[model samples]
Target: MFGGSDIKIDVKKPVYELIVEHILTNYNFLHKQVSHHVDVEYSAVLTGLALGDGRIHSAFKRARISDENAGEIAKKLMDTNIVRLLKSRKQFTSWVDDERVSDKLLFTTPFMRFWFAFVAPIFKGIKEGNYDEFNQRYENKIAEFREAVFKELSNELVKISFAEEKVVETGAYWDREVELDIFAKTASKKVIVGTCRYTNSKLKKSEIAKLEELANRAKIKADVFVIVAKRGFSSELKSLKSEDIRLFTLKSFKSLL
Candidate 1:
């Protein structure tokens, strides 16, 4: 959480607790990094982006700020490299309305995302040495937050796994009709669509079925279908692994190292 640090880590302590002690509780450090760049208005919009779906419309609404104000702040945030706009991969068609499809805002770094998501809103409480709200929010939302991080990392793994095929682009694909967790196009124009499940249960063949259904719904012909899970897969899913189908476990991340 502190980036590169010489501080010794205690193996027995929970990571969440350590983050609280070292990062969240230290207002002076946070202020030094953020004060020059953002004010309360900027911070509120950032917190909205972190807490909500990252859509510009949704973020503005969540922040209870006007679209004009949010738009300006979002641009400033992007200019400072605090966040980036992620456009949807849905193919533009005459029939599909572009204005209806909203672009998402993503933090440039995981630590900033974590800070806005968990620490910024409840900063007053933390500043006062009260951690009940922070702890409860962390306990409830950590899995969801980690799942997003896992999906981003899985994009890198996909590029590595497809070593023979150069992946030209990779990101989440979303439209008004459907949302796909992983979407990539190889240099040969082959479409690869997949999903990530950061859960303890083993993935089943039904996961593939769901992915295919989403692809069909989105009118995307996937040349490859991949499933990334926290645990391993069921025997039924394992049986179908082939050149067209791929499965990855959490252990696959070691290759990234």
Candidate 2:
């Protein structure tokens, strides 16, 4: 439906406006569900809860709300698609005692993440036309912000690698002890887990050991170990590497793009 008849598009303003509109719309919906007044405690609590890489308990503490209230609101927020709750992979969770709530809640998109993080917080400044404050609060944690993109890219890479096997689970894995950035399973029940490093530095050999250590702590016997780095790997990791170690640089990701 979004086609054009040789129409030239003024891309910049439209993109920003569209994103802003979405942010405002979701904010309004959330506001309505929580309270009649738009700028109230509920929205404030939500902003505190959503705009971080933390669990429900952490968010609740950040928002200064009770666990009961936080769980209720988190459920509502998750139900409304403003955010989503991803449980730690069952492989790791099954070993834990009683399988306590080990789910991570995050915004559905980076835009929503940014919106709740920056825009929603400083909306008053924007309403008052104070661009200075808005600009000041714009914290672009590039690696943190780009995590969702990296996760999806890794998922695609897994599908490519397991084209022959029935790729079962392809997502992240985390427990109290460790967090595997990308965790997947094949039809033959083969486990594949890895991490993503989007930085200027080269991937170090220590990373391989760290992944192995974490997997060991979690009692996961990963068949394939993958590393997706922005820069290339270190010479130490390159030489005398085990066949299980697989590497992918930023250039490697371009194939999927």
Candidate 3:
């Protein structure tokens, strides 16, 4: 919707074109909503956040800036409500002590993330009325992009699903040796480890085994396992859902609605 009224959808227009016309091209529209403090340094940092997988260290590296500069910029961004940091989950053991793990820097809103990832990176060509570059890059990784967003949403859904458990803390978890899409703890100190798969096919029983293996490697004694998928689950996997396991599909998100 634009200007407090619904804009008619053009069925034949490409989604990107629609986005550019309705959002990107309208300078005044964005000027009214987004921060006006964006400078070259801020743009670079945003590009880094978009491409660096939200890792502070990686963002600095990807943006070709020093850690000190990036750290300063990140704090300012946080203060301005542009981005926020998610601290790395602390672990008791030192199984992968040699490897370094950094806290993640996330955009406060999806719109900012989308802008940096797709538009800002290729703004020169876009300004010249050439969208080939943007279209090519977007098409290649659109599924992966959507899945990343879905994983974040799944975190909220998981929190909502376990009403009795009362999740105390939840977020993405990564160690030198292992990574999980969903790593949460309940008020009762029960660990919940899970995965989110956005794919065309049904999630199989093997996916459960993989999550368990990762939890084992991470030394987490998971009391409940979760699987959120786009295309739902296989019949075999569906039949296995019990107190210990939970399965959720796109339709499961209706609960959030």
Candidate 4:
């Protein structure tokens, strides 16, 4: 039973601030040693991590920038071309009204995707290392890593669900007593709660029951239930039939995209 209040997670620092400080300091230190401008692709990757996962305060703590212009500062860093842009006009034709900005800017980049998926977790592990039993405890949690990846792709998932007329609002949610991995709201005020399970094992009925209970108790409007699994549902879950319940495998999810 994972209660929202029981999850003792810390607010992490933004990766962009760290990258900026790293560039400034290293550029000064190695100005005579290196001759290349720090790559924009790499900076973008770091900024994505900072903006998405790193704590806002942490970025300020590292750089001491006032809150009034943090967004401007971040944009300036992003515009420096240290990080490569990934989205193009052709990729987002249906989503954007301004083609000029679409061509000049990217919605996202692979490096940021990679950092959010892999580097962030690894960094945490290294930071919390225990030399007494480092090797034994340092093994990565593959399931968690995969869940993070799914979180990064949540925007796309929401778009797919919307096209299917199954979702209205898609965003992550967590509070003092509860946390939903993916929350989709419908126009009728019905809520579609989903979790991304990235493993070989099938989803159990107990998990579905848990989701249902959470949805029922959530301090938000909800009417539908959804479970998105990578491996598929268990026999017990497959047998479930309810008007509010819906099941989707990863393949089915991708097909929508």
For model 3, residues 55-120, the per-residue Cα lDDT tens digits are 888777876878767768778888877678886554533244666678788877766777677777
Ranking under lDDT, best-scoring first? Answer: 1, 3, 2, 4
Could you tell me the lDDT of residue 122 within candidate 4? 37
Where does candidate 1 stray beyond 4 Å?
Answer: 1-13, 91-99
**TM-scores, one per candidate:** 0.91, 0.77, 0.86, 0.51
Q: Residue 97 CA error for candidate 4 (Å)? A: 35
Off by over 4 Å in 2: 1-42, 91-94, 240-243
Clashes in each model (backbone N, CA, C under 3 Å)? 0, 0, 0, 15
lDDT of each: 0.83, 0.66, 0.78, 0.48
Model 1 TM-score, 2 decimals:
0.91
Q: Write the per-residue lDDT of candidate 1 for residues 1-257, one digit (tens) a residue.
A: 43233345675898976786777667667756766656666888888887776888888887787877766777888998878999887752123554467789998877778878898888888888888998899989888888888888999999988989989888888887788888999888889999999998999889998999999888888999999999999999999999999999989999999
lDDT of 4 by residue, 1-257 (tens): 01111223233645434433332223334333221433433343343343443333334444455667655554654575433332321221123233232112222443333332333333434334322232332234334534655654654565475555655566554433455666766565565666666768888998877886765555444566667777888888988847667677777656545
Worst 10 residues of 4 by lDDT: 1-10
TM-score, predicted candidate 4 vs. hidden true structure: 0.51
Per-residue accuracy of model 2 over 95-117 as CA lDDT, tens digit each? 65654654677666554455556
lDDT of 4: 0.48
Candidate 3 lDDT (Cα, whole model)? 0.78
